[model samples]
Target: MGIFTRSIVSRKPNESMRLIVTTFFGVVFGFLIGLCFPKLSLTKFSLSTSILTAIDFKYTEYTKLGPSSSTHVSHPVGNNGSSANVTLRKIWVPSNPRGAERLPPGIVRAESDLYLRRLWGKPSEDLTSKPKYLVTFTVGYDQRKNIDAAVKKFSGNFTILLFHYDGRTTEWDEFEWSKKAIHVSVRRQTKWWYAKRFLHPDIVATYDYIFIWDEDLGVEHFNAEEYIKLVKKHGLEISQPGLEPNKGLTWQMTKRRGDREVHKETEEKAGWCNHPHVPPCAAFVEIMAPVFSRDAWRCVWHMIQNDLVHGWGLDFALRKCVEPAHEKIGVVDSQWIVHQSVPSLGNQGESLDGKAPWKGVRERCKKEWSIFQTRFSRAEKAYLKEINSTSR
Candidate 1:
């Protein structure tokens, strides 16, 4: 009975030890199988989420889809002996939209065919802005060198119109700077004739001043910018530069003195007289270089009779434009141009009916002066009569 009892106790301990050893070996074998075939799944165990993310990151080439691969990836696809069911997707995106229409004359309106533009280059409903000065010169082929030098003096703020009398572009177009000027090469017409035809008062009403200059001027000492500044300062409506004293100065008012701003009144000698209506002390400038104000030019353009192309009798009668002609019409002494006195145009006077061109021109000048005097007297009497009748 004692021996059987001892045997039972020893058998029970041995069975317990055998069960523990079997359990440890089974656990070790399962862990080894899991490491070898990581993708393999069982009903009881699943793959680690960190391991799945690391695998996805390693295969994706780090394309930065949101913050993590799991953010855009679908549900973990089961590998049931078939290919993994995977889906490529983008994260959430916001919408982009256009703005509202508020303003008129939009791109569509401006591009419409109904638009009428006022621009000289391309007409639109837009108004035009005119330049400060309109400078016209009657250029001959022989005096192109002089014109080149004169154009250099301008600051390029004014418009230059060149009327070519000789009508040859070979000499004038040879200069590189002539491309900037508006060259009008016409045949058999004088400067005044061209002025009458092209430079109508209403067309040039946009400019503040008009410069009708001759071609034979030496502008070595002259600066157009400074001349404009001085003209505005002196309040001159009709003005010209003082001629070089040594050159041909028929009128004393146009003579350059010893560095003065202006010379409106010349001194009277024992024999000379200062007439209120005459030049030298009155408002007058030579035709060689005359700068007229817009308002004054409007008046002067009307007084220039259509038949009187010589422009003689015009300088003396310029007081009709501005009443206080002496104050408004004076010579600028600060900036002066040299009259080259080149006789290119002077020698071109021709007569078709056996009379010399110069002789015809001279005779016409004398006749125009006489006619202007008679016309002035009639105008003055008419004005007086009107004033007297109005007073009554």
Candidate 2:
């Protein structure tokens, strides 16, 4: 009985050993399967390590390296891609009795003869199919002394729109000396009103090309014929020559917020360069010397608000009409005329002590600018809509 009991105990021990061996082999087999087929594994250690390594390497390259550190593209045409083309027809000036007397009669006669010949020339006839360009000017009392000079400078088929703003008799008599020039005198009651209303209209329709210039802005070293040729080549709607003020004007620079001292210094040194797109469009001045096509003048005249108190908003008003339509406005290579630098209605206000008549004018201009912006925005929207609809 003792021997049988001992044998039973030994058999139990062997069964226990067999169970332990089976469990160990089973665990090993499961581990090998997991390594061979990653999708079966719960830990996912090997796959995770590979994905992490790839991400880290990709980020390292992208964050630390690439092209496009120092390159710039140039755009010669304006953002809207327009070019200026202009043709010169007849040049017009305005003057008074005094201005006429100051000018030389001989010079006036010479100019008149030259202009008559040019007007009768084949080229002028071919361009306008008309014999004359009704070049006209307004004359003030102070302008009589330079009448001859003015006449000599602007030799063309001419008309003289005389304005005797000053209370004086015999003013019309002064212009009688030039038989080639037509003269009309305005009464004091209607001087300003008439001058502003009809200043350029009569001749505007008479000529395909028109130049409205101050009497004092005389032409020197210029051939109107050559200028006309160049303008025709470019096909500009409005054109002006380079205007150099007799005196230099300084431009001011101001600092912007968050700009470093170094950047500010650089900008100051650079001043303002020509705009990438429109070379001569930005910050341009000199209303005294612009030449306009018949089309441009018509556009401007129609676009001008009747309520515009005076000619103070002419530049800004014209820009609004042209820029959006992608019309060409340009400066010519020729230095055509010398402006006398006379102050007009808007300039009456700028004083050293700040008491200027133009404060109201400035405010009006600001309001007008705002209105222009709104109008342009609406126009742009309309244009885009038309383009989209057409494309579809």
Candidate 3:
């Protein structure tokens, strides 16, 4: 081997051999250099990836934040010579968070309510007890006596809200309970109009149940606490106190059944119902004194059309919000109320085209009902079409 090596060394190499030797050594040197410095790239890359993953996890995990809470995060960015300790702050903010950070958590992000607060008391001392239910009456001064009677039936567990359509809110303060009641004075508006504006789901979220009632109803035979108990026991999410069968009752479904405590379905006129479980035959209640569970109100509130103030067709469509509507929607027959059916709101309308005020108002109610039906039908069709397309 020494002799062979000596012979090769003695021989002069060609230009191609020199070039080949240089190329081979160059390739090997580059590979060694790469292996030596691999840790710089691999270690930095893995560290950065881990840091980024941790930051991402924090962002998703801390979706809700208390007023005093914060996340302190530090991440090194860029290369070693120009690296920076990047402080990333993902502050919790409301949807419109321009100045929300400085406000109290309750004022900024908590569920709202209509509780009357004292001007002088500490914030926490404003309410002695938080009511579990909300009862709203769209009333006029003419029906104050009736409203007073109705309010008496509900206990302190309810928050009394009066929508004075006649613009006489202060007058209601004569009653002892009215001092604590929340009154909204908006003239010449229907109960549905008041409800849509003031009874937003967010505003009433604290209440377990919400009663949107007309002022004409008489609560002589009804007990609000008992009604709540019966509805809960029967698993009724949407319900109304049954109407006295004798007093100009429009539908048999709403008429009080003396034999039963609560009724889920009623036999309507022949061909009145499309199916036995559908509205009028079942899952039906008149809107006069309808009560809604918090969850049910969320859905029902969305269905109340902004333009259709009379709420003519809303009762029928309420079943859409609840599942097994026949089982979940019903009437508490034992806690029945008398529907006085006073045409007071109709008098609020102005005479138009030689028509009486009430006549014009009734006409609008009927017209709104037709418009609502058409809108509902179209909305259903559009929804079905979109669903079909997406499914395909």
TM-scores of the candidates are 0.63, 0.45, 0.76
Deviation (Å) of 213 in candidate 3: 0.4
CA lDDT of 204 in candidate 2?
50
Rank candidates by TM-score, best first. Answer: 3, 1, 2
Q: Can you write out model 2's per-residue Cα lDDT over 126-191, one digit (the tens) per residue? A: 433232333444445566665456555444444433434344436546554455444455543222
Q: Which residue segments of model 1 deviate by more than 4 Å?
A: 1-130, 268-278, 351-356, 386-392
Query: Tens digit of lDDT per residue, candidate 1, span 48-151?
Result: 66367647545543333343323344344456534343543322212211221221112222111111244355444353433477788888877877888888
Alpha-carbon runs more than 4 Å astray in model 2: 1-131, 134-139, 146-148, 160-172, 176-196, 199-203, 221-223, 248-275, 278-286, 316-327, 344-392
Model 3: per-residue Cα lDDT over 72-152, one tens digit each: 444444566344354334444555347665443445654688877888969998888999999999989989888888899
| lDDT of every model, 2 decimals | 0.73, 0.47, 0.87
Q: What is the lDDT, from 0 to 100, of the residue 140 in candidate 2?
A: 56
Q: Which prediction has more favorable lDDT, 2 or 3?
A: 3
